[model samples]
Target: MQPLPLLSGADPTRALDAIFVNAPLRDYGQRPRTNDYTLPVLGMAYIATYSQRAGFNVAVLDAEAHGLGIVETAELVNAARPRWAAMNLLAPTYEMSARIAAHLAPDIALMVGGHHAKAMPDRILADPRMANLRTLVLGEGELRVAALLEDEQRRRELPGVLWRDPLLGTRAAGIPSGKPNPQMLGPDINALPYVNRAFLPQDPYQAAPTETDRRLARNRGTDLLKNAARTGHREANIVGSRGCPYNCTFCGAAVSANPDLSIRVRSPENIIGELDQLHAEYGVTAFRFVDDLFLGAGRVIDEQMAAFTQNRIGERYVWDATGRINVLNRLSDSELDRLVQNGLREVALGIESGSDRILKAMDKRIDAEMTERVAHRLVKHGIGVKGYFILGFPGESHDDIEATVRHIRNLWALADNSPGDIRASVFEFRPYPGTPIWTTLTDAGHSPDALLAYGDVDLTSDGADETMRQRDEFNFSVDIQFGDVPLARVRSTLATLTREQHQRNQATQGAAA
Candidate 1:
């Protein structure tokens, strides 16, 4: 809640082993690069928390939220003089990561991980700009970091760790191998410390309001007035689970990184315990589950729901999470009913496209019928549904785009409860280096790394950024229709949808009153 005293000056006496950073993303025109919608980097936060619990003095810094540029961030790290400095990686921040590593390396043992690093370990570790990078921690970092701290030599020995091969001389005969050893996964997540929310800067963060949020406010599902009072209160994110079983092509999570696609869930007690801490200490009344898939078929779902309802945790707060449509389909009607009755006010469904063909291409597994079924079901049970859609994949056609739009309209039509209760947001597809789509493109002889490095697909632009800019403005707001879809028609459809939803929202609100 208070400004970090460590920022003023690290305790000279304290042996600070590591500093975890959520590196600032490059500005994309009007949109500042940040950890998705102003959210804290819980991954970095967890690593910091676990490092501390492991008897290492660790500090977590969120450069984007703090508005610190690379130079300033590097200065702060240098001042702290930590033995190691690690940053979470995202594809958009690749250049930033390289620059930061270049500045902070040599002096500090630099490490990088997260989606980008996990997805492209060899590429990241091989990049000459990352010459100072001491190692790459793949997959989960909580245990690997602690192990590295306890035994500095383990950096080369640990599985899930890819360090510069020491045997090769500085002048490599060929390329240096940055492969990881076969090591054990970290201890169960239930045993790890809760994310250190209190250490975060007091400045509040909110993601840019989604199209869904704006519509839901109109429908009166979201309380616009109460938001002002809640704005300053800590709005936190916690994960009940890690990994999703589904193999969506665009996803860079377990599918891209872990491969096995094994899902791991924390005990409900552990999750609730963390919530209690946040609520009691920081008054975090609003929260979001950062889990890849928050709901599933069996005991985990039942226990979590039972815990929230029976313990009244849900009564104290309202929260939302992401889940696959099919997984939600697996829940009994009563189970889904229980979640909505409690605090499950919103759910983001990965209904990638309305076109079953496109959905299959994305490997979403669930089809148009299943998506529609789960969506209508959630709305019937009074849960707000946010559908995620994407366009501009490599082979996407005008018909595919129309199909997705049709699906969006169908979802909007199916929710009979209120206007704005059902909403869809469209994003242009960017083939990050490791996603299946990216791999597919790369295998077909297109270099995604080169394109991304050249700022082709990224939001940040230059004169060289022209080709990607031409490909489409590549805006996630879906404000720009990339293809044959008439911009005027698209705009008109959006306007009509908003107007209809507003009318329904007003009618619903009036009837309730």
Candidate 2:
């Protein structure tokens, strides 16, 4: 079966035995490409690996990294002719991903799952298009898929799994499907298995710093402190500490079983052990903590500092991480010094808004003051800080956006005092499924039609209200049409500014040469 605009005209049976339409971001929407990223999604790779271990023929079409559109990807699937597919994706992108799945899987047995099915299992069963679905594996999918494979007849025993009959109209119209609940994967992700490096193209993120590879490679935090003997940069991906605790109004609150899984981390020693391993095995020198938020400033960072001090492993490594603005705001100079002394050189702080009203609306716990304070502290500590801001939220008006731009102006002045000590990054608002914003906008009937469509708000715009220099928009996106402010005008301005910045940097490099 071919996807849209094409159908399988040849034998579908000979293409392959099984395939799961792996929908990468490109499989959902388009944006100016940045660094190339791997396709496995790490979590899905676990399922795929175990499935492959079960002796099933498996293939993944990582459309994002390869820059293949959905239609083009579906065509590849039809060509491959996998008779059975287990697929899933976020709810917002599910329509497109599923439509493609349906096209290439006309005769094949298809199973769809993800946060969507996990949140709305019965609603999915209402659709006849899903009638042919073998099973909708919810929650953790690795074990669920394995169990489904092991028990050909299992509507009776699998928790967290939903399925229609594989044999319809054969006197089994109302079969009780299995409910298989997969356990959450954590702390022991390293115990699972290494991903197939072959899935990536030549030098994923070739344009990115070498640290990107280290983050994805051997130094990945297993038990923390995994790299004890490393003398330099060691690449590692952060094992999430206490996965997000708050369900801010703009965020989907109930996505996890325990809403307030306060920040948790393996002992600093455990993380260091992993870091040592990466240096020993891969000669890695730099590290980036891939946590959503790095709030280990006081407790975790202090412990890590103590461990490093005790072990005499100082100045042997440098690292960067993402964190909430508040983390820096409350840190003392000494704590900041310890982080820098131990090689924590840079940090990314998410300042969601400059407007207090907008911040309140988004339930962002931090204010522009907090952001400014944090930026200053970071500069004083000699840590390069990157500020990420988004525009558009539940109740932000045009004035709110202007206020946000003003926040940026003020931040720029502050950032300028420590030139090169901090950089600013901005993105338009995107409503991810399972977040409060997604449900609220969707429930309130105001969500955008497509999650893939990039919005018009640009923070780095010269068109940004220059009148309010003190009112720089720190971290905000324009979710709604601004009253008098022409949107996307800022986007163009920022684009020009970015180009000019790049050119100037090149010129400086040339002159230095």
Candidate 3:
């Protein structure tokens, strides 16, 4: 099916078999874009690929990528008149997704899935607001999507689908349709076909510059923007594996709706073939491996690297991925060197906290010592490190906060106090539904809905005036507080760290000049 113009009056002659869309999760009306780093929603592309291969005509609408607002998105969908429309949703976008479903409902059979649906289907489907939503595909969607498209009669019986079976009885018209969910699908990652990137925009989606971006460009000159521009506006994301092996209590991926805990790795040959196509067709040389744990299984990494070496997959492309510190600690210097030589430019690590106590409580088997060692090694080897830290675990104390500060101070000192290469991104703990810790907190009388509301306040924006935003301004993190750490002290420590990193960026820029 051809892409429909937002204002065009022409409708598709016949309804399509399926339409896949990726919607923005913003609450205050749909903005042009939500995130600074926007990549095409690869999961939606994967679902479209499977549906098309199963002899169904499919149309994918990456509304965010196309810079379309909610109204425009609905118009485009209405023109397509697809039999069923499935949208990939995130936690922040749940309320917005419901609104979109309501707008496109009755005429189109609406199906919703992704993180929010997978994590809290019972609550999501039970709500009267989502009455128009027909099906909720849980877990791995590729297999279930293909099954649903191929056999419409048995769509409810298909695993990984929490669909409204409206034909059950007199009671089936409402909430009863969502009861007794189907079993989740256990899909083989290797068996799935390459993502249908053809469904996405050709030029790639670039985030509209925010006030901070404008300020940085004005103060720091064009160096930041120039480097960003050179990285190109067309980076694609690939998933080599699904699911992380470790059960970190704070993670959504850990306590997934899928019963399977094993990491499923795509074969090296299959991955390389996709890369070859991207490089040849799209002129794309940079890729982001959006895996929960890239090195979750050590052997998979070894095999993938070997294939890259043999097939020269890495020589023409540069990429980054996420990894656990313990997994990185296990790699020998030579093994690490081989990966760097094969275009491993960066890896994001979930360091979470510097306190061993917090790490243990969070079930992050690796300790501070190992984290420091691995981070140091990666930097020394010329690979960039993006460390993620969570400031407020429910049980963390002032001393734990100081320990994290000390660890970050040491990490900054490694680069001679420069933010040019080594960097850290911190987020305050948000108690997402379906996580182990979230379950524990809610079990103890805390309302998940209240916590979620607190989380939605934008801590990163300068204009936010919410109470949480005020607290975040002082602590340089979001609202969630742990133990008895004074927010003022946390603010001071964060300001000092921020100053040190600023100095580093200046020094590095000076040296370059």
Candidate 4:
């Protein structure tokens, strides 16, 4: 079905209960056009589905996917005439989201949530643009949102929710002493309804290939061709789990940063059920797990893999997922083989830095050596590796960055000799609110406004012009120097690496031709 009419005005008699909006990253007209792939907002879909199951009329508006600008987005939302206008906020898209929220009809009671909102509730509440914001949902939103939709009067009594009191200004309801109330931690993962994708546009969303996928296609013929000849290449992002248990200093979603979030995973059966549904209903043959941890550690991975194998999922579809380096390192070779046999295409690893010193500073437990070992093992088992690296951390030195460059080279060499591929996905570090590094920088006298002043990163610029189509493949940094390295040096390093990767891709394509 076509996406629900976005600009069409709603009927006066049938106003929507709630409308979840995924705001655009920036004004497309103000920036160079980028070929960034857009996906349906899964978070919004989840919350909408849950609210719908509770007998509420909910709709989702994806301004980003539809490429709607601030004014157009606001118009579409206003046209819906929702009683509540909910939008997710992120650091980079803060300005855009705020502008959209500001333009929303005053009659609509606004509710904002997400990592950025959770981190800086006071700043959001104080923003002049968000004057209509009635509720600021924090942590996991499904429960709090449903409760508020059911009865706005209970906003003050709901845990993980913040609202303005008539007499007392802003106040948190269920949260006590800055700790998550166990009573409001939402339901079991398996108990949550599958996200309703019908709310999304019917047209197939684009899925950009990874660096490894490009390399493999060049060397071993294009699987894209084969897939197109069969069921066609439809892809969807799936989530088998939620929350991270680790305390990585640079991550806003770190366990310590989000104390209200509890790490939870769905049962193997539940995961397989959704996979089957997507494959049947949407022709989704390719799945990318957007979970912080897809299969988890120890026996959890084994149990999930066994279920996939039993279901013959690998035979029907190929998938990629994120995993911890240390956890994968402990897996036996047979386990690795099983993963490959069960259609594990690539594993995204957060190998933050190559320097042990930098790793320790970022609270990333795995070192360069451990990262290399894990990459080699996964590649040997015919599973590709995507190593995520960060440069220019606060206090990071020139030597530390050089170590990261050398490490990237070593992994590339390892993939050259192995059957599987490897991709170095690197970025310049930018501090995010609520992360450990954010606290450190603030403690050192860095103003939050100044730190956040670096606006939405122009991914198409900054030496990424040639790889704009692959913009979604890697996170873009604001290029602001937060470390010992000069900003010029950081830009040069990032440009050089990006240029080399692009050249390698072109060369592989030429060779294949």
Per TM-score, the best of the predicted structures is 4
Which residue pairs in candidate 4 have backbone atoms (N, alpha carbon, C) closer than 3 angstroms, thus clashing? none
- Model 3's alpha-carbon lDDT is 0.66
lDDT of 1 by residue, 279-353 (tens): 787666667787876664466677788888888765566678887787788877898768865567688888877
TM-score against native, each model: 0.79, 0.70, 0.81, 0.90
What is the Å distance of residue 302 in model 4 from its true position?
1.2
lDDT of each: 0.66, 0.54, 0.66, 0.77
- Which candidate gets the maximum lDDT versus the true structure? 4
Shift of residue 33 alpha carbon in model 4, Å: 4.1
Window of ten residues with lowest summed lDDT in model 1: 462-471
Question: Candidate 2's C-alpha lDDT?
Answer: 0.54
Model 2 regions more than 4 Å off: 1-20, 24-40, 49-59, 78-84, 117-132, 164-191, 194-238, 252-283, 293-298, 303-317, 417-420, 442-513
The sequence of per-residue lDDT tens digits that candidate 2 reaches over residues 1-513 is 333222111223334445556554434334433333442344455466666666554555555445566677777777666666666666544555666665665776676776666655665665555556767765556655765655545635655456654455221222334532224322244344443333223211212232222222233232222343222233444443435555455454332432423345656666677667655655555566766544534566566678866754544566677776665677788877777666665687767678888777677777878878888877665576767666555466677766767776676566554522555565455565556766667777654444424333334445444322222222234245422444454345344434433444345335433
| lDDT for model 4 | 0.77
Segments of candidate 3 deviating more than 4 angstroms: 1-3, 6-14, 28-36, 66-69, 165-184, 202-234, 255-257, 417-420, 458-483, 486-513
lDDT of 2 at 399: 79
